[model samples]
Target chain A: MTDMLPTGATIGILGGGQLGRMLSVAASRLGFKTHIFEPGANPPAGQVADRVTTAGYDDIAALEAFADSVDVITYEFENIPTTALDALEAHKPIRPGREALRVSQDRLTEKDFLSGLGLKVAPYANVESPDDMASAVAQIGAPSILKTRRFGYDGKGQARLKSGADADAALVDMQGAPAVLEGFVTFTHEVSVIAARGIGGDVACFDPGQNVHKDGILDTTTVPANLTASQRMDAVLLAANILNALDYVGVMGVELFVTQQGLIVNEIAPRVHNSGHWTQQGCTIDQFEQHIRAVAGWPLGDGSRYADVVMENLIGDDMDRVPEITREGNASLHLYGKADTKPGRKMGHVNRITPRQN
Target chain B: MTDMLPTGATIGILGGGQLGRMLSVAASRLGFKTHIFEPGANPPAGQVADRVTTAGYDDIAALEAFADSVDVITYEFENIPTTALDALEAHKPIRPGREALRVSQDRLTEKDFLSGLGLKVAPYANVESPDDMASAVAQIGAPSILKTRRFGYDGKGQARLKSGADADAALVDMQGAPAVLEGFVTFTHEVSVIAARGIGGDVACFDPGQNVHKDGILDTTTVPANLTASQRMDAVLLAANILNALDYVGVMGVELFVTQQGLIVNEIAPRVHNSGHWTQQGCTIDQFEQHIRAVAGWPLGDGSRYADVVMENLIGDDMDRVPEITREGNASLHLYGKADTKPGRKMGHVNRITPRQN
Candidate 1:
């Protein structure tokens, strides 16, 4: 039973967002039940999960009870509170492990880890105070992005440094939080490799998907991305290198910037990523199920691409287009049951699949 | 809201079986919440449904509460008690309606309805007692089946009549229940069409699938079923005819017997059928989602087959083969989180997908 979770075993999830919702559905497919722990009432994942603890991560008692009820623990987001992890890990194993989370929870640690593994990453310098920002700007030069070292997502908590004069203004954006000044790497496009590592240390990566972002949020991801044969291999190999370096178990989203020199590591997330949502229609096994299999100690599934797909996020008013999308052939819609639709919120996504081009 | 259920609407499901489990997952994809009503403790569907009411259909108070919570209602199985429908329909609209349940609940009524619509049906006669059994055997001839008109599924409540001399013995198997004596139709292979009709009366049907039954239970269903061009067309047309005649607003599985002369109607299930499970991998929108869409008052989705699939049921001890199946490339395992596998029980199924042949 330790080698793999038996059928009907409960998998504890730390977040109850759309990723957790999809993961719960995938776990159910493999005969595994999911228990979601979220502070928010009526979280989307709670609608599909077997059990939900509507207590915040700071509530140690609720966290312990949730951990005790599940056989294994995984998460939808990487930035889990440290105290919550300490309480849960004592009862059950947290998959993708603490090391993967440690490396990914901060932009600085992730870049350093990727670079230490001899993988290409954009040049960066740590920034803390105004003095640190001045030095980082001098080292990295203008046209660099200042991103907070921790707790930043969907392009929040960051400011662009167009010139050295903008450094103080950018530092103000961080609000005294530690930051990283990353030198911009001129790239043709952004692509992400959704990779998984089994408990047995076996690695599998889905085809890279070219992505487009609108207002700092992912707009669409098209599979069979424009990559040379060598670039594709490099992208997968670099992802596997990162996973192996961390001794990672479960899926990791490896975002890469396709540059003239090579595929530069942008960042990594130690759970299912939005760009990989295309696998729901492009492959036999989706990223959510792949993550579940790894965390549950099952062999990684085949990640072969079987269809050409373009996954588009349904943000806010994009939901108004649902009726039209419902009528469109080849478009598969996945909507998160959120009560309110606000601008920039991810309501869901649609995967438009077509016959494979190659 | 009258034309189509808005996202976040609750769909009340009548039964909590594997069909309900899959339907709940499908409903979640469309941002719909599901409330499952099952008498049994820890029903498989409860693992994924948004809510569960553990009460029998005879509990009028519980049924009314469930119906009040949902915007629409549907069932996984057709043989819902009349009293349950009476309580539920008064609260929320039940898609596929009571007409479908009435026609399909009794075999004699179903056969007559098909024949009445100019559809070919196996020769059949009603049986109420020993005298009726003798007359049925005389009229339908030898090599027939005696089936209880109600509560029959998975080859249950049935006995074979090999000859006139076996009439009394087959009557004993009925145990005084109303029955149907049906002459077996000579056929090459059995096929079924998974059809759906929208609230607006538009119809869509998935490609026919060839079925193989072992121990009176479906073993496997292969898409691109060996049907000639004309036989395939006839299969879909007959299925649409039934839905149109019944004014059905959900998915229906129409089992057809392919004879040398033509396609003959066997029976129709007013919900997603096991034989249609192959569509999970072979079609853009599987039958479960198709049923949800129709019941939710949305337009029918694309049911076009995208891959060749062989859906194999994992029954009883076949659960032992799950580890091996999980490793098989192009195979998608869907296990019902049912504890304790006994002989002749359905544990789950796997869809092995391959490129479409034609």
Candidate 2:
């Protein structure tokens, strides 16, 4: 039957963070159970999920056991080790596949894949060694960001090089790994299109929201972002093409750089994303539930927005303001159970929904 | 600092049904863990919760351990034995308390309590024995019901006395137990108010919805309830008064019968009610989350309805329609993990959100 995931069907998810926690909540709403496997210290997802296996990323035995328990498997984030994927894929259906992982895990491959899709990306050069770094610096010039080709997340594992003299230290910092020096682009704004694609190839997108970062961490996202109507349409169209191209089945957060010419793809998160948190109070379906529905092979839910939204992350001590934030009638507070409130950690968030009905 | 219950807090839930399941889901959302203590062989809440302790209803040792691990306690259904509650109350904070449970679990007590609050109730009489039943039958007459004073639910342990001959058999069927015989009132419609009150005495009521029952099981609930403005005001007033009287701290569903005389109080559910499931898709705060917020000592949410709604339960084999039900653009489906779907068992429910602004 169409959009019917049989009862007792299990959905395996990789990465056990807030994304997985929210995903598990959504999966339960649709009659599917989520089994989360994450190699971390009691990830939040473990709390709400039906089952969880805490094993290191390269632990093939645990990965295989996890894969065997579920009907379909999806990941909360890119950068899952290829070996882990190889083992999981052998036993379960992994949506978005090795190709989506291969491309999005590294900036260089991501750019190349997008470029292959005839999308515009910033100029770049690979730095394999000091010699290659020197030549790559000569080609890409000053003010380029030298980034390790893998394992970088949330602005970590990269160094911005303003001159050639810093090349040696940058390469040494990267520890003899292959890297890319990408030319900096002057962009109008940073925005992301949080979208989902069903296995049957239907795609739905939330309107692009302007994102602002503080110290390389997402600080806030406001809907009705400073984009022309055409730009919004362009973002959805581009996201749908990529989802179909990769045959991706799940919600993806497509970060894009809005330039004067058009939108340039930034990166893609193959799960429910932070930027779409507004959906919790602003839309017919939240991104996490939407993602679960897609991966469970269920029909995509209505993605219509009911309100103009402003979402602010409750970082570290900001969680202390939860009582105050939630006291406002318009705010929808969501807290992720993190034990320690260390600085810069995303402890929770609040979405203030103001209906645009008037 | 205000509502944060320390880390590793275990929230103990008494009844392990879907309300508990959904509550566990919300509790998990806030980083709080759950331990489901149930007497049933299998509890739907146990499927997604962190821990489950299955034992007899009167097992004091099991109840004690369940309470020991939990920071705060709550129950899904109102029928917790007073002895079991006494054991639990010795260890943890049981929100809504034994008084509320005692009042709601017995139809006689519930009706009496509402009547004491000056709320309108159907004419009623207590039947403690067959002789008491006969005397009450003389007063209440035919077309009334004889309900066991305790441990009755979903039309179980209740019998309709259509005539004097049936009255003796009804009391005999009631098995010499304490019972309540009520005069039947002709009603134009049935409705219920799903509301919550916080420890601080904050009261929030969702608009009452008209309910329809098939074979004594709730079949559907439509919000706006076809109640006139005065009727809606009366329903909310009755609900608020009930919460205040009980000093209740959680979501409660108060069923009402609207007759030519006015709205008559039917019964109350001390926890999330099936009739209130529409809140998931209709309101900013669903009953499950509203109950959590109340028990957690947080401020009550707005409980704002975003749209008109209709909720249908997927009882027993009715769950087979999930595929077709979910395909509707507006319905939100919720299913429990029951290994076997038996006749008369509630497997799940679906909420249909009608197209309207909040």
Q: Write the per-residue lDDT of candidate 2 for residues A1-358, one digit (tens) a residue.
A: 5555687688888888877788888777776777989888778887777788999988889988888888999888888888888888888778867777887888788888889999878778888888888899899887878888888877888888878888788888888778888888879899999998887888888878889988888989998788877888998899988888888888888899999878988778776788998887777678988887787777888787767889898888887676676567867777777767888898888887766542
> DockQ, per-model, please?
0.79, 0.53
Candidate 2 collision pairs:
none
Give lDDT for model 1. 0.94
The estimated TM-scores of all candidates read 0.99, 0.96
- Please state the error at residue A289 of candidate 2 in Å: 2.4
Cα lDDT tens digits for candidate 1, A104-158? 8889888888888888888899998877888888899989999999999999998
Q: What would the TM-score be for candidate 2 when compared with the true structure? A: 0.96
After best superposition, candidate 1 residue B103: deviation in angstroms? 0.4
lDDT by residue (B1-358, candidate 1, tens digit) is 3588999999999899899999999999999999999999999999999999999989999999999999999999998899989999998999989999999999999999999999999999999987888888889998999999999999999999778888888888889999999998899999999999999999999999999999999999998999999899999998999999999899999999999989989889999999999999999999999999999999899799989999999999999999889889999999999988989999999999999887
What docking grade applies to model 2? medium
